[model samples]
Target: MLRIADKTFNSRLLLGSGKFASPQLMQQAVAASNCQLVTLALKRLELDKPQDDLLSPLKAMNVQLLPNTSGAKTAKEAVFAAELAREALQTHWLKLEIHPDARYLMPDPIETLLAAEQLVKRGFVVLPYCSADPVLCKRLEQVGCAAVMPLGAAIGSNQGLQTRAMLEIIIEQATVPVIIDAGLGAPSHAAAAMELGAAAVLVNTAIASSDNPVAMAHAFALAVEAGHSAFTAGLAHHNNQAIASSPFTDFLAAL
Candidate 1:
């Protein structure tokens, strides 16, 4: 089980509600994944359009909603977005994403840190989406962050753990949950992250854009479980010299 803040989750795979063809399909994908926590971007919601009904479908599934400040560019903007989401969504959980650059959408570390400190003070469960910087993760944990979501690659890039070395450092250092978010394109990537000791992984575009979203979601779910099991069961280290699995003494004596 993955425990973050006060909640304990059975599933380690967190799904994003974006890029899917429709809300129904999104729901189907999420159900197939069996994820307990689902991320929703505040900016993407058509709140003014009642027909959109994004929250309704999510609520129907009885999953925890993780609202994100996806478009915020600064500390002040992200805090404001978080407050709005709290009131609108009626949840204290917030995903802090402050990216000033539109082209790359790379998180601004300075702004993210500033925002995280303030959000923690305001009594919100802050989960900052940050770069795979081990130093930054330690700082965030010091400031009372519920968890740190370090990106494996650029958001929605599906690059799959480009920053593996750095992420391993963060996972080793973090006292809070280290959720591998962003850029996981396939189930194998998710499994690799779990095997590397990540508490969870957040996937978006890859699963949503797959030819069969439901099947892909199921695959990811299985991958995460298998990887976590491997981690718990203990994996063997690589060795240059081969070791025989079976004892050769009996065979040699018989011969």
Candidate 2:
């Protein structure tokens, strides 16, 4: 079971509710993925509306709604967004992301850390989407974030684990869950992230943009299980030279 804060989830796959062709398709993808947690951008939500089209199905599925500060460019703006989300969703769980760079959408470590500290104090279960920097991840953990979501690559880039070395360090050092987020484009990528000992992975573009999103979501779910199972089963050691699986005894040599 994947445990974060006070919540324990059966599935380690986390889905982002964005970029789908329709709300129905998104729902299908979510159901196929079997993710217990789904992230919804605060900017996309209609907080004033009684029944939001986007939120209703997810609520019906009984999945945890994780409100995110996706468009916020500063710490103050993120805190404000977090407050709105808490009131709107009636949940203190939040995914704090502050990216000032329009082109790359690289998360600002400073702003993320600042926002995490403030939100934690306000009793929100903060999960900051941050750069693949070990020091920054450690600092975010120190600030009482429920989990650290370090990027594998740029947001929606589908580059896949560009910061593998840094991610390894972050996973090795993290006291809280280390969720690999962003730029994972395939089931294999998700599997690789899980094999690296990540607590979970947050995927958006890869599944949503796929030709068969529902099938792709299922593929990713299987990959996550396989990878985690492999990790738990323990992988074989890497060797420079090949070693024979069976010994070549003198009796076999006589033949």
Candidate 3:
């Protein structure tokens, strides 16, 4: 069981329900992924005629909602949006994303830090998405974040862990769960990141943008489990050359 603040999760693979063909397909993918937590965007909510049908299927599947501040521009906007998400999604667990830059959707660390500080004080389980920088990660962790989501690369780049070195540093120094988010194009990338000891991974584009999202979700589920198992088993150390098991390296013992 992986614990994030007061919440304990069974699955380490967290799925996002965006960029899907249909809500049905999204539901199918979520089921296939075996993902207990699903990141949902808040811009689609209609207050008066709240169509809970979309949320119904996911709720039926017993998944926790992690409402995200996807399009907020400033820290104040993000804080207000988080309050709205709490009302609409009926949960205080928020995935904060304040990307002032639109081209890549890269998070603004300044805005994120401010938002996280406020959210945590207001009784929210805040998880901020930021660049894979160790200092920024520590700053967020110091403010009582449930977890830190550092990008592997640009969002939807499918470059597959371009920021691996920085990510490794973030993981090493993080006090909270370090979920490698974004730029994970394939299950193999997720597996590789998991092998490096990331607590979890938040995947969306790779699954939602796939030819067959449901099937791809299952594939990722298997890969994450395999990688986590390998980590638990303690993978063999790397060596440039195979060393002889016998005492051949010792000159005194050599005949």
Candidate 4:
């Protein structure tokens, strides 16, 4: 089970509800992924409206709605967005992301750490999306973040495990859950992250942009399970030289 704060989740795959062609497709993908937690961008929500069409279906599915500060450029902005999302969604679970640069969407680690400290003090379940720096991740955890989300690569880059070395270190040292987020374009990438002992992974663009999102979501779910199982089963040690699995014998020569 993946434990974040006091809540425990059976599924390790988290989904971002964006980039889908329609709300229906996104819903389908969510159902197919079997994710207990789904992230919704605060910028995409219409808080002033009586009811949101997009939110009703997701609520019906009974999954935890994780509101995010996607467009916040600073710590102050992220706090305001977090308050608004909490009010709108009626949930305190937040995915704190402060990316000042639009081109690469690289998460601002300083701003993220700042905001996480404030949010946790304000009685919110904070999960900050941050860079793949072990020191930064430790700082975020020290500030009481429920989990530290380190990137596998740039946001939506489809590059797999570009920061594998850093991620391994983060996972090794983290007391809190380390969720691999962003730039995971394929199921194999997700599996690799799980094999490295990530508590979970958050995916959006990969599944949303796929030709068959529902099927793709299912595939990712399977891959996460497979990877986690492999980790639990204990993988073989890395070796520079080859070792024979079968005994070499001269019995064939005698025959």
Q: How many backbone overlaps does candidate 2 show?
A: 0
lDDT of 1 at 129: 94
Point to the candidate with the largest TM-score: 4
Q: Candidate 3: misplaced stretches above 4 Å?
A: 44-52, 243-255
Residues forming the 10-long window of minimal summed lDDT in candidate 1: 42-51
Clashes of 3: 0
Residue-level lDDT tens digits of model 3 in 1-255: 678989898899999998999899999999999999999987754678846478889899999999999999889999999999999888999999899898988999998999999999999999999988899999999999999999998888888889989888998888899998999999999998898889999999999999999999999999898888888888989899998778775677656
Better of 1 and 4 by TM-score: 4
lDDT of 1 by residue, 134-236 (tens): 9999999999999999999898898999999999999999999999999999999999999999999999899999999999999999999999999898889
Total backbone collisions, model 1: 0
Ranking by lDDT: 2, 4, 1, 3
Q: Rate the local accuracy (lDDT) of all candidates.
A: 0.93, 0.95, 0.91, 0.95
- Give the Cα error of residue 161 in candidate 2, in Å: 0.8
Structural similarity to truth (TM-score) of each candidate: 0.94, 0.95, 0.92, 0.96
Which lDDT value does model 4 have at 108? Answer: 94
